[model samples]
Each structure stands twice: as C-alpha cells, then as structure tokens.
Target: MTKEKESILDVKLFKRLFQYIKPYKGVFFGLLILVVLLAIFSSATPYITKYAIDESIETKISTDFLFYVVLMFVVLILQTVFQLLFIYYAAWLGQNLVMDVRVKLFNHLLRFKMKYYDNSSVGVLITRAVTDMERIADIFGQGLFMIVRDLLAMVVVFGVMIYINWRLSLIVFLMLPLLLYATRIFQKYMKRAFEEVRNEVSNLNSFVQERITGMKILQLFTRETIEYKKFKTINERHKKGWLKTVWYNSIFFPLADLVSSISIGLVAWYGGLNVVLDGAVSQGDLIAFIMFIPMLFRPLRQIADKFNTLQMGMVAANRVFKVIDTTSQIDDTGTYVAEGFKGDIKFDKVYFSYVDDEEVLKGISFEVNAGDTVAIVGATGAGKSTIINLLNRFYEIKDGVISVDGIDIKDVTLSSLRTQIAVVLQDVFLFADTILNNITLNHPEITEAQVQQAAKDIGIHDFIMSLPNGYHYNVKERGVMLSSGQRQLISFLRAYVTNPSILVLDEATSSVDSYSEQLIQNATDKITKGRTSIVIAHRLATIKKADKIIVMDSGDIVEQGTHEELLKKKDGYYKNLYEVQFLQEEVI
Candidate 1:
C-alpha cells in the first residue's frame, strides 16, 4: 500500500471529530473546568511546602506550622477529587463520542455502492471502523485534557518560581529552547512512523482476514507452507513499522530526561550559591525551586506523549472521513412510490460494464411480463449474472433503460424498488444465528407463523423440523452447520417470505445433491407461481419449463424462445449449447 503524507496536526479533521463532542458539551466543558482546578491545586502544594519551611520551621512556631500543614492537606484533597472527576468525565465523553462515530461510520458504509465493496478490502474497512475508532477515543479520554492539565500546571509552576526568585527562574528557562527543539524533531519523525504503522496494521488485517476466510482453499491446494512464509513476511513488516516508533521514543525520551536532569542541577547549584553569597534566596525558596523543575519538565515530557495520542487520533479521523466522504453511493433522489408493482420488467437496449471500456452487456433487450418465469442461460463470463445485478441497481447500467410496471427503475426510490424484488444467488449467505432469525432477519413484520407457512409451502418445513432444534437451530458462521443445499432451501424460504412481486434465482440450484435439487425445484415452482421470475442458470436441462429461455454469449443474446421451440432448431446456438452442455443429463 502506498502511504499518504498526513499533517501531524490536522485542524480541519480535529474540528470534525470535536463535532461529536458537541452533543455532550456539558460533560466536555465540566471536564475542562475540573482540569484547570486540578492544575491550580497541584501547583499550590509546592508553595505551601515553601511557606512551611521558611516561616514555620525556621521560627519553630508549632501553631503556625500546624496551620500550614492543614492547608496543604486541604489542597491535596481537592486535587485528588478533581483528578477523579476528570478521569470519570473524560472516559464518559470519549466512549460516547466513539459510539456515535462508530454508528455513523456503519450507517455510511451501508449507503456505499456495491462497487465500493467490489474493490475495497473488508478487513481494512473493519480496521477503520473498529481499531481506528478506539485510537480516536484515546485522544479525548487520555490526550487532550491531560495535556491541558499538565501545561496549566507547568505555567502555574513557572509563575511561582519567578515570583520566588527571578534569577533562578531565568536559569531554568534557558534549558527550555533545547527541550522544545528536541520535541519538535521527535514529533516529525513519530508522525511519519505512526502513519506507516497504521498502514501496516491495515495491510496485516487484510492479509490475515483473507487467509483465515480462505484457509480451506489454501490447505486443499497444499499451499500452507507457502502462505505461512508470506504471512511471516507481512508480520515482519508490521513489526518493523512499530519498532520505528519505539526507536524514536528510545532516543528522544532519554535525551528529554537528560535535559530535565541538567535543568534541576542548574537550579540547585545557582539557588544554593545565591543563598550563601548574597542571602537573597531562602532555604525554603531554594527547595521549592528544585521541586518546580520537575513540574516544568515533566509536563513538557508528558505533552510529547499526549501529542502522540492526539496525532494518532487525527490520523484515524482522516481515514474514517475518507470513507464517510465517498460519493460512490447509489443515487436515491427519485421520489416515486407505488403501492405495488405489477412486475412487468423491460430491459430496453441496455448497455453495462463493470469496468470502464469493457462492456459486459451490449445493447441487451428483453421483457418479462407479470407472472412469467424466464430463464437466462449462458457459459461463465457471458454476462448472464450481470443482468440480475443491473435489474436490482446493484450497479448502474451504462446506457438505455430498465423499467418495471411502465416506470423507469431509476425514477423510483431505491427502497421502493428493492423492497418489491428479492434475489437468491448461487452462493447463499447466512448469519451465525438461529434458522428462524436468519430467515426473518429480525423483521418484526415477518412473524414466526409467516416464515413457517412459507417454508411449508416450499416443502422445506419437514426438513427444518428434522434438525435438532427445528427452526431454532444455530447455523454457525456462514451457515457452516448446514449443507449447501440446506442453506439454499433456507434462502428460498427467505426470499418467498418477503412476498416479493419479482423473484430472481441466479444459478441457485447448482452444485447441490439430487434430492436437494428436487426440493429446490419444488421450492422454486411455489415461489415463482404468481411472480415475475428471472432465473440465470448454467444447467439448461432444469430450466426446460421456463416460459422463455434467453441464451447469452459474450455480451450478446444469441437466442430467445421456449425450451422446446429452441431445441427444434438443430443449427441454432441454444440447440448447439444444449447438445454440448445438457444432452448427457437428458439421457440420465
């Protein structure tokens, strides 16, 4: 994957991320106030100690020292309370913001055109939605507010030190420029390193996800060792990406520590000399100045760490926004709605291509009247399935029109268009859910009674009852608990339960047992009884009962007629294909 250069601090992206916090502004602003109070109380403790040493301890006044000690305790108690409040509120705000972001990202993904999934990696999208979102939460939970609190403490500490003795303060301030310069250099390198790390993480996710999903294929082909080597190579790259960040931290953090130690040493040496030579700085003031050195430098060091969190959030936000900003969604501006379509589908001189300059359908035209069962047959890559894709508007046709019930499909709302049409593909997908939930898909309107009746009508009700749990049986991931043929039966029932006006079966019965094929054929007959049905099939013998058969080859329809009508033409393309493809099936 090519890396894109991203700014360490993207103001616009941060502004967008902050918009999610706007709804919870009460909590956000409350956290801000608590952070400031925490800083003030923490800074006050050092001054209290200084006062105790100089006024109480030096004079040996017991009452005065006791009063100072009590005041210091009050300050510490308030700081602890504020710190707890800050932690709680920050966590609440971050979790709420991430929840909102994740929902929006998921909803946005639902709107993307099917073409986007065709080209994008499911694993990378999962990373953006899941892992990247967590990093963004860290920006709010641990990053921004902590930076604010630390910086405020540092400023307050510096002000107190200057007030105690300006000479010592100036000596300490001299080390600031060198530390700031080192921080800037560290930020630059860490930003690039983090970007690479995120990219490698995404690459690794994509690789592992594909490998796991295709493990059966790899092992069947005896490619386990080969794939293992490839995985190690990718894993090594991911490790190297992370080590770059570690290498930067190792060098920069110790250098920061060295500078901080030098600053403390300078303060101690200068303040002690002033106390002895001129009696200008008291022992308590010298002690406080030494304590203030850590307060100043520690914040600077922590700001570097918090800034890393901030930068990572910005990177994650940029990736998330890229997906949300994509315009590759089906246009749903058409306002047309009908109570129900009559299911008269017309493809008039339609042209389509999945890729540019490569036409899959060349001026294909056909019509299926309401209640007709038309089957499309062709060899692979003949654009047979592409027809089904266009009818559902999963893709946009390049030219011409596809209409249903005398209304151009493009002029109707997507929801209205799709709700009336149901498709069952060759490869069925089932969620890791109960058989009933997989069929109903959580649609309240599709009740248990409706699903059972539909399954019974399709002759699969007994088959489902034969299972261990009947309709409640759990079909493990991708319906792995059931055979392919059983999965197809469930799909037919699912499609039937929708009571769609139009039904599409795209090679739905291929590669199933003979008994299962018989069941599927029975289910098909029931579902397509009164609906306008289009079937795309490779096994032409099964579609002999279709009212019309459309033969497609290389982006063109070579023949169209009833099965017997076409078989009468000895020299015809459909007849020739039937002899070569289905003559053996007829003999059997």
Candidate 2:
C-alpha cells in the first residue's frame, strides 16, 4: 500500500476542487434549486396527510379531506419532476467536470520530463486518469450535493414535526444523540478504511499491468505458478480492505435503523397515553409523528454513507491534483526557433546522472560538425545512449553546457530543436495503429504519398507492399504483429519521412537480421548524406564508413579517430574491440 498520509475532510482541497465547477455555475445553481424544491414537496406530504385526517375525522363527507388528497397527489407529481431534472442535470455536470479534469491531467503529463515517467508506475497513472477521475465525478453525481439535499429534507421534516407537537418532537430528538454518536464513530473509521481500499486498488492495478505487459517473459521462464501466487496475495489484500468497509456498514446501518424504530415506539407509547387520558395530542398528530420520525432519521442514516462517498472522492482528487501540480518538466523557456539549422552539435565537458551522485556521463566532450557522421562505439552501459538522451534534452546535464551552432541548445525552443532531429532507437515502439499512421504519427503535413516515397527511398517499400493492406496494415500494440527486424525497418521509414536535419541511430540495426541490417544500412546512408548524424553501434563493421569514430568506456571517451587510423595502433581500445568483434562475427 502507498505510505502517503491519509487526509480527512480537507476544506482547502475542496475549495480548490470547486474551481472546476466555475464554468458550469448555471447548471450547478439550477441543481441546488431543484434540491430545495424536492425537499419542500417531500417534507410537506406528511403534514398534508395530518391536515386531511384531523379535519375529516368528525365528518363523513368533508370536502376539505378530498381537497387535501388532491393537493398531496399534485405535490408528488411536482416532486417527481424536480427529482428527474436533478438526476439529469447532476449527471451532466459531473460528466462535464470529469472530462475537463481528465484532459487537463493528460496535458500536464505530456509536459512532464522523461524522468517523471522513469520513476512513476504506468498503472498508478492510469488509475489516476481513468478510475480516480470517475470517483471525482461521483462527488457531483451522488456525493456532496446529494448529501446536501438529504440534510435539507431532514431539517424541514424536523421543523414540521415540532410544529405538529413539541412533546413528541422531543422524544424523536432524544434518539438523535445516540445515532449521531454512532454515525460520528462510523465516519471516522470508514475514512481510514476507504483510504486502504483505494491504495490496495492502485497496487492491484500496477501488478496486473506489469504482469500482462511481461507475460511473454514470465511464460518463457515458466514462472506462471509463482506469479499466480503473488497475484493471489495482492488480491487478498484488496479483498480485505473492501471487507473492512462492508463490516463497518453492516454494524452502523442496523444500529441506525434500530434507533429510528425506538424513536417511533417512544412516540407511540407517550402520544397514545396523552390522546386517551388527557386529550393533549390528537390521533392525526400521533400518526404524523410516526411519519416524521423516519423522515428525520433516514437522511441522518444516509448522510454517513454519503459523506464517505465524498471522502473517497476527495482522496481521488488529492492524488490527481498531485500529478497536475508536479514540477518535473523540462524548462522550455527559450524562444529561439531553430529554422534552417546547420546541425553543428557540441558537448563540452558535460556531466549527467539519472540518480544523484551516480554519474553516467562524466566530463565527456565531443563535437559533430555540419554534414558529418559521428559513430560512437562502446560496450553495454558505456554511456553511449546517455549522450544521445542529453543532446535531445530528455534529461538535464548535471554540470556542463551543450551547444548547437555555437549557441546553448537550452536557448532554443524544445519544439524547434527536436523538429530538426530524427531518432531510431534500438527498441522501436509503435502504437496500435495502421502503418501509415505510425509512420506519420497523424501529422497533417506528411501525406500518404510522402510516406510511400520515403519508404521507397529506404528500400522497404516492397516489404510494406507485401503486408495485408500495405501502408494501411495494422501493427498491433507496440508493433507485436511484426518481427524485430521488420519493426526496425518500419522505424527507419518513420525517421526517413521526417526529413530531419540531424539523424540519430541508437543501435537501430543491432536487433535485426543480416538482411534487415543491410536494408537499414542502405537507408542510413541515404538519410545521413549531407546531414549531421550520430550513430551508436556495437557492430564495428556497420560504422566503418563514419567520418569519425569516438570509442567510449566507463562514461569517458578513451579514443577518437577513423577506423583505419585507430586500427593502425598496436595497442588501442578500438583496435582490440574491432579484432574481438571480427572474430565473433566469423564464428557466428
């Protein structure tokens, strides 16, 4: 469960929440008016009944009794009309409020730095956006406003009972202290119970999302039984949390009903004696007190449950607002737009770390001149990818300046800087969409013909034509419908279509077969021509034609030269790497 502190009935949080309703104030006020009208009609019914009975008890044909019955019937019809309108408008307001919140949350997420995503769980975020937002909608639909209406009805009923007979009203009022005490205790514990339940729900969602996404790995390792046991453990916690709330409900509601029944019994016993012995209370007044007792206590009973609903909604809103208030985003304060960029990139004594004091790139400095292709060759975890990520400002550098064309890249707008660069990562991610949509990413400027031409230029047009619908063929979630090599080809086509000024291939061809590698190599040459390029590769043979080679090891550049220049050294890092990889390729 999350270790965050649970908040109860936070007034400031509610004050902040009401800001979302500002746009729909007219609908909100109209709903309140309906609640008041409904309460008046509903609370007036028993008094009308008392009037009809008391006036007609002495006469067989009293027109006053007949008139009161018709009046009560008309009141019911009006109450029903107001109730219908209240339900419809309340739901409308709730849906509109949630839609606004969901959009704002999504927009906030989009601006967040990649570091935020690195530390956050996908399932938790999804729960905040989808599940938690629904709870917030319940605040308007069935939570705070509904509680208001019920309490208003209770107040009116209590006032009418006092008007009918102050003596019987006192008996009913006496029952409140006991039920009120019970309700207070119930509300306190129920808030804690709801917090546990919501935490458990988030935990379950996280576990399920992770397991399903990695199901292939689990099955390959034959750990299904082990995973199943883990799942059962999490599910058990969720069940326990819910059962605690159920237990509280079972205890409190029955006690409330008992107290209500006791109030009616007391009223009957006392009022009947007065009617029979002293004539202090009439038969109509006694009957009206019975009706009023339930009306007064029912809302009291329901308010506890409804208040819990309000508390849960508040909890959900707190979690979502935390995300919206997050400051983990790249500062795109620069207004300089990189139009017709020459792509002269430089990293000058840069330092970076994903975690505090654990540097991944240490005082590394390099430059890529206009139209030059620079290849970075290193073993795994040698800070090759870190350099690419820094160049794109996916993360802020710890202690250095990175510049493009002699100006700090931080001074350039993120959109303009990124628009000129196209990257093909080793692990390509495609949406559950058609090939054409994935390639263009639904950009209005890039037409289908442009994508086809780019595919043809990259030597993968025929491969695409072989699919079911060519460019229109769906590549399920994360492009699972295609093989690794085929996905890489699609990624290449995506990059080619962008016409970026600088091209980056982060081990793009490493995951593919020899045939796909050859195809990607051809595509690489076509795109990198007359464009500054950075290629990180484990395969030394693939980058033989690079304008320059920077060999890195343990977060530092150990050597920098061309392939032939480095190979001439008898004891050089690149030479040793080339010899080992050459022999390994031959063995394979």
Candidate 1 lands at a TM-score of 0.98
TM-score of each: 0.98, 0.97
Put down candidate 2 lDDT per residue, 130-216, tens digits, no spaces.
999999999888888889999999888888888889989998898899998998889878988988999999999999999999999
Q: Which candidate leads the pack in TM-score?
A: 1
Q: Residue-wise lDDT of candidate 1 within 456-487, one digit each (tens)?
A: 88899999999999999999999999999999
How much is the lDDT of residue 447 in candidate 1?
93
Model 1 misplacement above 4 A: 1-6
Tell me the whole-model lDDT of each prediction, alpha carbons only: 0.88, 0.88
Per-residue error (Å), model 1, residue 94: 1.4
